[model samples]
Target: MNIYLVYWNSLNKFCFRGILDESIGEGTHFLIPWVQKPYIFDIKTRPHTFSSISGTKDLQMVNLTLRVLSRPDTAKLPVIVQNLGLEYDEKVLPSIGNEVLKSVVAQFNADQLLTERPQVSALVKETLVRRARDFNILLDDVAITHLSLCWKFVTGGNCQRCLEDAVTRIGSSCRKKEDGRALNSGCYLRHSPHKFYNNSSSNDVAAGNRGHRKMAIILAASSAVLALLLVTATMGFFIRKNVMRKRRERKQFGTLLDTVNKSKLNVPYEILEKATNYFNDDNKLGQGGSGSVYKGVMPDGNTVAVKRLSFNSTQWVDHFFNEVNLISGVHHKNDERRKNTYTSESLRQRFNRDSGMHS
Candidate 1:
C-alpha cells in the first residue's frame, strides 16, 4: 500500500509518500516509511489578533481590535498539493488578514464600531469571506472583539463626563415627573391667555400682510403691463411714421421721373440709344403700358429705370403725365379707386400693343 501526505503551500503543491516528517513546521512536507516517518500537520484554525487605527467617514480616529479565523480548505488539498508546496499560511494568511481588516474598518467610525458591534462584525466577516474565496480557503468568522476611544489622543477631555451629565438630567426629570405634589399642582401644564392671544393676533397680522403683499404684487404687475403697452404704442407710431415718410419719398421720386421722361420726349433716337443701352435685352427690367423699363446705372453709380416708348403712338406725353399726377394725389389719401384705375389703363395699353391693335 502506497500512502501519501498531500498538503498546500504558497508557491507549489507538495506530496510526501509514506509517513510525514515530524520535525517539519506547520506546512506540507514529505515523509518516509519504517525508518522514521510520522505525518504531523498544523491543520488547526489559526487565530490572528491585531490592532488597527483608521479614520471613518466623518474623519474620526477609530481603534479596532480584530480577530480573524483563517484556514485552508480540506477539499482543495489535492489542488494545493499539485500547485503550492507546504507553507501556505506564512505566505497567504498575514497579507490577507491585514487587507481584510483595513477594508472592513474603513467603512465605519469609532462611535459606530463601539456602539454597533454586530454591524461592524458583519462587515469584517464579509470582507474576510470575500478575500478568502479567491484563495480557495474558508474564513470561518471575523469578530470585532474590542472597540474603544482613546479620548486623550482624540480630544482633550474625558467622554465619560458627557455621558454622566446626560444620565443625571434624565434621572432628575424622571424623579420630578413621578412626584405627587408636582403632578397635582400641574406645574408643567400651566397655561397663559396672553401668549394664546398674542399668537392669534400674530397669525391675523401675518394673514393681513400676505393679502397686502398680494395686492401690491398685482398692482406692480398691472403697472408693468401698462408700461409695456405704452412702449409698444410709441414704437408703432414711429414705425408708421417711417413707413409714411418712405412712401412720400417714393411718390416724389416717381413725379421727378415723369418730369425727366417728358423732357426726353423731344430728344433724338441716337441720344435715347446711348441713355438706355441700345434697348438691349440685358438692360430691360419689365414691360409696362408706356414702354419697356430698362435698369441702367449712370456714371455717378446711381441706378435708374429707363422707360422707352414706341414711335407713332397716338397718346401724347401730356396725357401720360396727367394720369401719373392723378395717381400720386390719391396715394396720400390711401384710396384704392385711383390705384385700380391707373393699373387698368396700363394693362389695356399693353394688351393693345401686344395684339398688334393700334389706338
Candidate 2:
C-alpha cells in the first residue's frame, strides 16, 4: 500500500500524489516504493470559502460568507476515478457547494436570513445534503456565520422628496376640512377674501363663524356618546334576560327529573319482567286497535297497567309518551275518584254482556 497526500483548493479541484522525493505537476501522479517517498497530508481539518452578493426582494444587496468542510467521499471514489479522473475534488465538490448555496439563498430575502439565522442555516444544510447524495457524500452541517448589507449609495439629499410628500399630504387634509365646513354652512364664495381680509369686520365675522362651528362639533360628539351608552344598556338588558331564562329552564328540568326518579313508577326491569310473566299471552288483558295491554302485579301486590305498542302503530308511537306524561301530572287528590268511576263503568258493561248470554 502507498500513502497519498491530498489537498483541495477553493475551486474544488483536487491535487494528490503518492509519496515521492521531489515535487510534481499540478494534477494527480503516481510514485515508486521506498527508494523515493513524499510526506503525506498531516492536517486534520480543511476549510473551503466562497464569497457572493445576494439580492433581496426589495432590491437590496447583501454580502454573504459561506464556509464548507472539505473531505473526500470514499463511496463514490470508483466513479470519481473513472469519470472525473483522480482529481475528483476539483471537478465535483466546488460545483456542488456553489450550486447549493446559490439556489437556497436566492429563495429567501436578506431580512429573513438575518432575523432567522438558525432557520436559514438548517435550510442550507438540507439543500447541500440533498445535492451531495448523487455524489455519495453526506454533509455533516451548514452555518451562516456572517451577513451584512451593502449601503454604498445612501445620501442626505435623497430624503428631500419624502419630506415634500408629507407636507403636501397635510395641506391637502386641511383644505378638505375647510371645504366641508363651508359646504355644511351653505356659503357661496361670491367674493375673494384675499383682498377684503384687510377689513376688521370681515375678520370678526370669520372668527364668530369658527366659534359656532366648534360649538356644533361639541354637541354632535355629546349626542354620539349618549347614543352609544343607550345601545350598551339595551344589549346588557337582553343578555341578562336570556341568562335568567336559561337558568329557570335548567332548574325546572332538574326538579322534574328528581320527581320521576323518586316516584312509584320507577319500576325495575326485572320486576316488570316477573309481573308480566315474560310477556306471556295469559297475562295480556286486552287487545286494542293500537296494541295489546297487559296486567302486571308488583312484588308488593300492587296492580298496574302496561301498554305494549304494536309495530305498525305509527300514530300510537308518536303520541304514547305525550299521553302518559299528561296522565302522570294529574292532581293526585282526584286520582282515586277517577279510577273508581272507570272501574264501575267497565263492570257495568261486563255484567250486561253476561246477562244477554244467559238469556
Candidate 2 vs. true structure, TM-score: 0.31
Question: After best superposition, candidate 1 residue 146: deviation in angstroms?
Answer: 2.3
Write the residue-wise lDDT of candidate 1 on 240-283 in tens digits.
Answer: 99899767644654564455555433333343455567768898
TM-score of each: 0.33, 0.31
lDDT of 1: 0.56
Residue 82: error of model 1 in Å? 6.2
Q: Which stretches of candidate 2 lie over 4 Å from their true place?
A: 1-45, 152-359
In the predicted model 1, the residue pairs found to clash are 9-85, 12-83, 12-84, 12-85, 13-81, 13-83, 13-84, 13-85
- The root-mean-square deviation over C-alpha atoms between each candidate and the true structure, in angstroms, is 19.2, 25.4
Off by over 4 Å in 1: 1-40, 78-85, 152-359
lDDT of model 2 at position 20: 25
lDDT of 2 by residue, 122-155 (tens): 8877887677667655455566667887543424
The candidate 2 region of ten consecutive residues with least summed lDDT is 180-189
